[model samples]
Target: MTTTTELSELTGDYVLDSAHTRIGFVAGAAMVTKVRGQFDEFEGSAHLDGDDPSQSSAQLTIQAKSIQTRNQRRDDHLRSKVFLDVDNRPTISFISIGVEQVDETNFKGTGDLTIRGVTKQVTVDFELTGTENDPQGRFRVGFHGKATINRKDWGVSWGRGLVSEKVTLEFDVAAIRQP
Candidate 1:
């Protein structure tokens, strides 16, 4: 006789492939200047237990000094004392404790995000885009997550009136399953 195992047993560790992922932010200013940047160095992973969604966990680490706003001059100023101060605080991270499902592919997760040595509770919304087999016969799952954060909340209050107060955070990630 054939038996079925619980969904929770499907949980597995996923290695983040940076080549297929990106973490970025966008903000507008004066209805003309749209500021955008991304972290070039980061590592993230997700542990998902399908049977028991509660068993899922996720974490992300970003290098503060890797932030690039496109303009070298502005990037340098942002790294100065008035801003990120990368020399003193070089890492930003988020660790999730639990996940809440809003729909089949949509879910919200509560976690702690640390930046510039400051930590705060943040909510990340993620969507599952199903899984597929690669040409090598390896299984892979994809997901996209987004969150909004206040730069000042994490002690990054270097923005002037010209810069917006809210920053839109986004992430695109893919994990390949190995047999």
Candidate 2:
């Protein structure tokens, strides 16, 4: 996995290989500790216009019901109206509005993130970790990105004292370029 490839060679449409990717979050719990979890199911796609970094775009959709924190009871509560309300809003999505190249391996994307029907602007900083040709002869690209959001803004404010409002969202994306 070498990230030294020319950006121009990566221009194409790519689909996220969810099995090799992870979308997770971390939040301060009880003002003393942290709770970490991840969504097990998600799909994403990206269009990379290597010639023009600003023309690059990406979109991601995560199943709200797939959140897991290693505890079934807590997971059920999270899927209820108190948190994601997966029954009412089964999906969380992000659509990139703009992208900028901070350098060769660093980039930033500004976009609209929708959670439980509420949409807010957020910026994610991405690191182009690497690109490689896998054993199956498929072209793969890897990226790690992160962003922070306020749960209260998305209508998830039940645990005011138990869980902090700010949450850190992390992405370990593995995408395959379309033939």
Candidate 3:
């Protein structure tokens, strides 16, 4: 467990550990079941000003064509123009506009999320899971967050009645501090 003072000592620049992080989403399907998927390729970085949490920031870029949903046909459909349109818009991105510490272990980040060439402001509530020194002697921090947004907001309105418009985005991030 990391204390508040320990968190302040974690201030630094960090690179997301893509191998240990997961960017996933869940959406209702056919109004009866749910569909879960994830993007396999992405890179992100963050600057943590633990002493002044307001100054903390992060940015991420995800390859749109890397979307995986267990089913190849569904994945192909998502890459089509009706959805992500990977050919024209090859990536999805996010840049934090503001960050606020809500408590010792919770934070709220507001950012511009771009998908399918459309940008919209979204807020995600994150909880600091912990911090640890890996076996390789690298210092790492963990955070998990979730945000709900309407698919149509980003022009991803292919399946209407077949798929619920509400989508829940989830993040399980582990960042390693840079030397």
Candidate 4:
């Protein structure tokens, strides 16, 4: 089925449907190959304003220890002090400072992203895929977003030669309106 939604009609508080959402990343390795990974645990919420998109906001927190690359050894290394240092810094978070609607289905979210112990401003362009009512009678909105960042800025500078400094993050999110 086809669905369309206007930003003015989406004003509400929503909770991310983590079961259907994905937060993943890609980084070049050895200047030749690319490594992909994802965080398995996260929670987020968003407040959208129909009248003024700039008033909308979102926040997300991800468990650093939950990083998965499909390789046990590599994943373990990433959780070590050389990378995420999950033991000392267990959570990565983002809080949106502002949002701008580019069009009916596109938006730009600017925010501060905290990783390890450092926080940096980043912007993610998001596309509102659609909105639908599930069989369970819940209204859901779906979005896809992406942003690129330098991992070194976040103090994750261990893999100088083995891994690329630039990391691209992707978000596939589905949120349900709060009652």
Best by lDDT: 2
Q: Give candidate 4 regions above 4 Å deviation.
A: none
Worst 10 residues of 2 by lDDT: 2-11
Task: Write down the TM-score of every candidate.
Answer: 0.88, 0.98, 0.97, 0.97
- lDDT for each residue of candidate 3 in 1-179, tens digit (9 for 90 to 100): 45334668779999999999999999999999999999999999999988998999999999999999999999999899999999999999999999999998899999999998899999999999988888999889999999999999998878879998999999999999999
lDDT of each: 0.79, 0.94, 0.93, 0.92
TM-score of candidate 4 against the unseen true structure:
0.97
Give RMSD (Å) of candidate 3 vs. truth.
1.2
lDDT of 4 by residue, 1-179 (tens): 23455667778999999999999999999999999999999999999887898999999999999999999999999999989999999999999999999987889999999999899999999988888888898878889999999999998888779899999999999999987
Instruction: Give candidate 2's TM-score.
Output: 0.98
Candidate 2 residue spans exceeding 4 A from truth: none
**What ranking of all candidate models by lDDT puts the best one first?**
2, 3, 4, 1
Q: Cα-based RMSD of the predictions, in order?
A: 4.3, 0.8, 1.2, 1.0
lDDT by residue (tens digit), candidate 2, 7-118 = 9988999999999999999999989999999999899999988889899999999999999999999899999998998999999999999999999989999999999999
Q: Candidates 2 and 3: which is better by lDDT? A: 2
